[model samples]
Target chain A: MGRKLLLEHINVPGINTLEVYRKTGGYRAVEKAIKTMSTDEVVEEVKKSGLRGRGGAGFPTGMKWSFLAKPEGVARYLVCNADESEPGTFKDRYLMTNIPHALIEGMIVSSYALGANTSYIYVRGEMMPQIRILEKAIAEAKAAGFLGKNILGSGYDLELYVQPGGGAYICGEETALLESLEGKRGNPRIKPPFPAIAGLYGCPTVVNNVESIAAVVPIINDGGEEYAKIGIGRSTGTKLISASGNINKPGVYEIELGVSVEDFIYSEEYCGGIANGKRLKAVVAGGSSVPILPANLILNLVNGDKRLMSYESLSEGGFTTGTMLGSGGFVVLDEDQCIVRNTWNFSRFYHHESCGQCSPCREGTGWMEKVLHRLENGHGKMSDMDLLVDVSKKIEGNTICPLGDAAAWPVASAIRHFRDEFEWHVRNPTLAVKENFGLAHYADPLPELVS
Target chain B: MLKVEETQSVEFSTELVNKFAEIVSRYPEGKEKSALLPILHEVQAVNGWLSSVAMDKVAAYLNIAPIEVYEVASFYSMYFLRPQGKFVLEVCRTGPCCLVGAEKIIDYIGEKLGVKEGEVTADGLFSYRGVECLAACGFAPVLQIGPEYTFYENLTTNSVDQLISDLKDKASKS
Candidate 1:
């Protein structure tokens, strides 16, 4: 009920300081876990809470921690995946910037659960400011005996470090992140070894996202089961959705999981409705990686649809009538927005971001990008629309990582829901709108520096 | 092919050493490698791009393999393996920026500098590159120099010439 349940005392200016955070009960979770609760107890508490990973994967946090192979004298690690590279997803950035201590505290408790004496927060390099905040927070935690030797006199020593990524979207994948952590190329590795079994210098490691760790602090502070009771079956607790794009007020909203799709969009409480008094055309319920839902299906609750925002509900029909709440990156598009153009934009990002390690993803992403480019820029044929769909199919599951899926899903989904628009663009061979409203906005060019 | 530290002929000062140590202390025990990025960053702060000598000092201080450091250095677009010009011009070439003619601006700079996208000029005044989204969407056409971001709201031939002249002026003053 209190804001501190997630972002408590965060807004009190200067509260980021250790002295202020201490006054607001910041490291209380770490202290209580180390001093009182056993490592298994902490894990059990988290498991009972029904807390799931907020890092798009939706894996159970306790189950992930429980998976670490505890070999004798072998080093185990807890890696906080702060890479936050998902587009329209900046919740982790907001959390790390405003509440660094929350993550730091959570990491300490989670590390203790997994017998990890050392933890690393792998932040994206582009987040230069957040990196500074984490470094400062770690220093404060170390100074307060919340980290380093015998934390809180419990003899359960742990250390934390921050590693910035080298600007590759693929590195956001756990194994690739581990590879990057090892100072190697940031390319995804085959699963089954899955970070938990072999990761971070080939040691047993658990890589949780920033929001996932932040959620852990609350689970530890409140009994895990108590936290789990807040949301619906299987989808427990609150999720932080970074809502942007054609929304009246685009910011991060902490919604109780399983809230209805309609309520999330139209409710005065959530996004405050669409921007510019425009009609909602469609929704990319998750991050850009998920399929788009048509406005009719997304808003239709009468025909046994029950468009709720949960793992089970959104994915009930498997893209037939519903989508996912992935990473809670809800990007709402208004009627004025062009689905074809937006999909093309995402296609280019995936093509540029593909690590070139997998043949299908490497080539398919480029082909899709080119097709989308031709479609968006008015050089496309009707066959190009089908070609985009066909290319997405080729790349979906043929890659080492889900990045291929992340690239293919949006284009595939947009085409599925808005094929007419893609066809319209090809048939017209001109910009969709006579006014070129968004294009005029794009007329001005960035400055040229001889450098 | 040459290592970063091996290329730096100058010896680092005690002040720089202390700065590097402070960055190293940010991480906890047996996690010294976590400080690799920041350490390289600090080294670059001292000597423009990561020279072989600076990288060597970083690897030695953190007890990491030099190739480990090199892998990270080369992988990131921001980290330069070779020395750049006085000013590093990073233009955003992603969707929002690209939609607004980022490519034209990059081409303009390439032509003016008499070099390609990644090359520095003979005079060492400028080095230009096209980067991903800089998160300045309000200013669709955005370029960053050091920490300063300048948005081209209404770019034209005149504005392009002015930007180049401005860079020359700023380079001379520095």
Candidate 2:
């Protein structure tokens, strides 16, 4: 098995409880950080770990902490973006559900490093169960003297609270999360004064994903250099891959960052290959927002090098033939699935979740959804293909948030990779609705690798 | 969406008022506005949905304008604008789930309930809707019932049938 930092004790009975978690060396990082290291020392350790934000952006976590504006007398905040709403991404929910205290411990250590006494975990409201689990965990930690005022008698103080989002996907965005936390509508804010500079009640704030925060525990416990030694260069440390869709074992898997895409999908150690012995057709290696790649492209690079599940490797060829390791939401599709219907389904999700903050995303997502809906239902015109791409182009990078680009990428990428499937839907409209345009060239053998 | 016929004024119980106070305490002193989402959830738990009267009352309690509450309530998918059945069955309908038969599960729930999406059953026992990704695609074909938001995952049609019956039995008993 790959090294597990966050989920090492995940299967331990009663790991969700403070006693079991503590017994298994859960809060050692908190104790080590608070009792021994300076705040800067903790930050320096994270910086040295080379941990990137696991929420999808892949921005360096240590650098994000370094960006926090530390103004005198101004309360800094660390808001854990527990709103794991991206389609196909459920690793945060899994991590938070199974090992609640790991996140709480990470929260305390991270809050200290950012010099924030007050922090809030902005969980999506649908995860009321997780919110309750975290709340119970936080209460237990506070009772154990790991949280609240003067923790561990180290003269450091911190207060952590769990805030529920109002079930909007856009709240997963950092600034939008801040807005939702304030109990306002979930709308993306214009950048340049990113959340690090001014956030959460206008205080200097840092918003990190749930997995990113939880990863801090091991970084502090093992020392950053030791933690960084596990994964491939730059994509240091293990990542939690939420493998879903047509995979045989569809669940969360903690993988060392450099694992080949083929091993992750087909090996018994990971996804255990496609379900029902079906051939793999396509894979959304990341969440729905990232480009969707056919089987041939996903398993190998354009140059026929084996694709690895790291930030640099997955995104090797850019949007053309490459996808992202976004949120590690690896969704696999077998031979039977229809790309057209799935594209339409994703477009509908984006349109429904646009937040209506920007017209390009707001209007553009609706157009994509409507157009894709027609295509999926076998009512598509030939020009509808170009129209879809045209609309996607208009929306990409034209909105205040990435939601526009997110909505556009899947539609554009599906057409880019599977235009014939879409054309088949158009030509054989009746047949398309009755049956899927099966695997086709997507499962073809890759060209011989160049030495 | 709050029709004149459905606007019923709500009274905050002392117990609930105390709960609101606790939620408000989690934020900074002046930023009691941060408590709005949690407070609305608490209020919605009491009543099945947020009426204009209830929302305005929430606005009054938070010291924010009533429009703030309305805007937030309408913006979010969770808060019901109309009265729903005792159990709101939210099934995941996004791409990953659909690949693994989430759409079938949603259709099953709808057909079994005899109520289309957003429509409450006559018995006032259940309502079902297709929600966007619940972030549980790994356990696709999943559904959850709210108040506690208890999840039911990897649902087959038979399992869904068992759930509806179980929920029906539960409602009759309680």
The best candidate by lDDT is 2
The alpha-carbon deviation from the true structure for residue A256 of candidate 2, after best TM-score superposition, in angstroms, is: 0.2
- Candidate 2, position A177, lDDT: 94
Write model 2 residue lDDT over A121-140, tens digit each, in one string: 99999999999999999999
Lowest summed lDDT across 10 adjacent residues in model 1 chain B is found at B146-155
Among the numbered candidates, top TM-score falls to: 2
Which lDDT tens digits does candidate 1 get at residues A242-281? 8766666666778888788878887777788987887777
TM-score for candidate 2: 0.98
> Evaluated with DockQ, which candidate comes out highest?
2
Model 2 residue A147 CA deviation (Å) reads 0.9
TM-score of each: 0.83, 0.98
Cα-based lDDT at residue B154, candidate 1: 33
Q: Give the TM-score of candidate 1.
A: 0.83
**Candidate 1: lDDT over CA atoms?**
0.75
